[model samples]
Target: MTPVIELTEIERTFDADPPVRALKNVRLRVEKGEYLSIVGPSGSGKSTLLTTLGLLDRPDKGSYRLDGIETTELDDARRTALRGNRIGFVFQAFHLLAHRSAVDNVGLAELYQKGERRSRTQRAEAALQRVGLGHRTLFRPDRLSGGERQRVAIARALLGEPSLLLCDEPTGNLDKANTNAVLDLFDELRAQGVTLVVITHDEEVSMRADRRVRIDDGVLSDGSTSFQGSVLR
Candidate 1:
């Protein structure tokens, strides 16, 4: 089967005064249903890599194949379509609208998606339940805790049953208890066959994944170790 994500000799550089090389000679492959983490500190190009992987920005040079489709030269509109349809994103900040209920927040993701055949509310509600937030569907962001809001975010990401989840510091704002809750949910997702790629600076989060890689100063290297598949919930 084709890999969910494939990057070969990926090179990304920003044209600053000194021309910062955000990613250098990167190569990675993430299989379907696999949970992988990329760990790095600030100024380590993690954010740049995440942006490239999510198609938010194209690489300066390289081949990126998503589910076997070459993406290097795809136009912005096509990239946006592919991103909305196939990629799920969860970030450190809960980007929920303050006035919208959890269900609405998730439903909004599908508002712009063309040819969707399901009821938006029904699909959004099911996604909330998947993240164990069914009871909070009617609540607004202000009424939810940090973890709950993040769950809402995750639910929004799951709107189209995205094949790959790109999470950047997903639990960075949550307390330890809430972090574990979110991680458990991720484990469940992995078991259910959603590919996850998390970019984090936290080692504990990195260790929970089946495989881990470290990115430092634009270079990528293996950083895996034997550990619990889900960590302690």
Candidate 2:
């Protein structure tokens, strides 16, 4: 089967007196329907890697192929278009518009797409219902619980039916109960054949994924160990 994401010898560096290497010779492959977690501490290259994978940043040198298209050589507009069409993002903060209803928030994701307004609304409603938030479609973010807000964000991400769902610290702000609720939703999404790549520091979240990789000091490794020892810390 073709991989949904492929990174070959990826390298990204920030210019400084000595230059900071955010990622070094990173190679990763994520197949369709795979649920993978990237675990690391703060300041590790995990965030940089995530940004690169999400097409928010470009590597200095490497090949990044998303769903078989060579993304590295694509221009900014093309990259943005591909990212919007093929990738979905869920963040820790549940970045919903304060004044918009849950259904409106999800519908907003399709604002740039060429579609009838009624069709977009129906799609948003369906996405919300898929995440078990059908009853809360009219609720605003401030009126919902933390878990519900996150579900709204997830529904918004799913509005485009993205091929890959990229979540960054998705459960970071939630309590155990809410975190479990979100994790259960992820399980359901995976069962429905959505590929998920989660970047997080939480061990429980990592453990829930089908595969776990670690990043430290710009180096990526399989499992949890590194030359300096445990990568979790």
Q: Pick by lDDT: which candidate is best?
A: 2
Compute the lDDT for candidate 1.
0.88
User: Per-residue lDDT of 185-227 in model 1, one digit per residue for the tens?
Assistant: 9899989998999999999999889888888888887744322
lDDT of 2 at 140: 94
Q: TM-scores, in order shown?
A: 0.93, 0.94
Q: Which segments of candidate 1 are over 4 A away from where they belong?
A: 115-118, 224-233
Tens digits of per-residue lDDT, candidate 2, 1-233, equal 77998888889999998999999888888999999898999998988999999999999998999999999999999999999999999999998999999999999998755457768889999999999999999999999999999999999888888889999999999999999999999999999999999999998899898888888888878754552222221
List per-prediction Cα lDDT, in the order shown: 0.88, 0.89
By TM-score, who's the top model here?
2
Q: List the candidate 2 regions with Cα displacement exceeding 4 Å.
A: 224-233
